[model samples]
Target: MRDIKIIWDFRGPAALKTAEHHAIHLKEYAANCAIEYTTIDIQTFNEFYTIAFIVVKEKDMLSVRDALKPHRAEVYIKKRRD
Candidate 1:
């Protein structure tokens, strides 16, 4: 099955920190709710932009998306270890 990335974007001077903190919450939520996910992480685009994201199976996308209300989503392609 494919994966889906659910992203929450943050912007401002504190974007990176906020995104990092948000990723922690995403992990907690998944643990508490028994949600299956491949990864949860943060990405910093710049000082003013960052994002927190969780990658889950495509089958789990709708429920997670409804509960999390993320800013965006896309197909997640996992990088193969070579």
Candidate 2:
């Protein structure tokens, strides 16, 4: 299996709020998709907002990425062998 980090930037000042919103949505979506092992992070720097997710496999990671694409911009995904 491989590990993957899926990330995307949020365009606004409300980074924390946006992250929290997406976290909630992600939780529900993950449960429905049967992906149990993942971590979601909300990062902010000055005027930048980003959401990051680490998962154990590319298949699972891509599933989450697809789910978040509509609400996120500049999506980036990284993968590593486990």
Worst 10 residues of 2 by lDDT: 70-79
Global lDDT of each model? 0.95, 0.60
For candidate 1, the clash count comes to 0
Instruction: List candidate 2 segments past 4 Å from native.
Output: 52-56, 70-82
Residues 1-82, model 2: lDDT tens digits: 6566555556677766776777677667777778865465666665655564434365566566676664433323544789
Predicted candidate 1 versus true structure: per-residue lDDT over 19-70, tens digit per residue? 9999999999999989999999998888999999999999999999999899
The TM-score measured for candidate 2 stands at: 0.63
**Superposing all C-alpha atoms, what RMSD in Å does each candidate have to the true structure?**
1.1, 4.9
Candidate 2 residue 24 C-alpha distance from true site, Å = 1.1
Clashing pairs in 1: none
